[model samples]
Target: MSISIIRLGIDFGLVVLIWMIQLIVYPSFLHYTTTNLAGWHRKYTPLIGYIVGPLMLGQLGIAIYQVSTDFTFYHSLSILIIAAIWIITFLQFVPIHNNISKGRVSESMLMSLVRKNWSRTILWTLIFLSSAVQFF
Candidate 1:
């Protein structure tokens, strides 16, 4: 019921989701042929967006609320990190995914996805850990 608890839950969800994406989902793109990967990416992006969109919005919204209400160090840090994630997602990842959807699949691009995702994996994990610390 507490805001901290809700924030922790959202952060935990992101941590798990990003790990799955980094370790399993993105890497699996390498196994697909170009045409198949493009076709699958078209479907996959929208479906995955359903799951990712809400969680990310929830996380960002809660972070903003927390900082605006309390203005503590932890809340500020969380909001900053969330902002970074959003920026990276839109500025970097979105274009790549858009290209992939348009049949621009390449081994280098797939590998870059896996490589670039480590930044998010670490950031989400850090957010979760910080949330856990605040919760406990």
Candidate 2:
């Protein structure tokens, strides 16, 4: 398959994944007691990373390739947005996840995860839709 197709798939996958995490998984963190929360989060983090890490890396690689080659508006924007997502993931979300995994599962923190995640969720959705426009 073509690189563009692969990138679209990555974007689409992330859109779905982030939505689920934002709406379902993060909220569900609240259900776990504080004692169990850390262990559950620690386990969930690595497993989710196994899924999310590759897709995220793939998307970044694809975006970078696209930009380096033709450097079109969409390609450049896609890379910039992907960079933003990565920045948010590492700078913002990762810290929160680290905290959660340390058994610091507060309602406010959970809410923050949900709230901050909207930036990523919306960005990924836009990228997916933009890629779809390119596809069609």
Question: Residue 104 CA error for candidate 1 (Å)?
Answer: 0.6
TM-score against truth, every candidate:
0.98, 0.97
RMSD of each: 0.6, 0.8
lDDT of 1 by residue, 50-96 (tens): 99999999999999999999999998998999999999999999999
**Segments of candidate 1 deviating more than 4 angstroms:** none
Q: Give the per-residue lDDT of model 2 (tens digit) for 1-136.
A: 9998898888889999989988899888878898898988888999999999999999998899999998899998998999898888899998898888888778998888888888988999999999999977
lDDT of the structure predicted as candidate 2: 0.89
lDDT, residue 125, candidate 1:
97
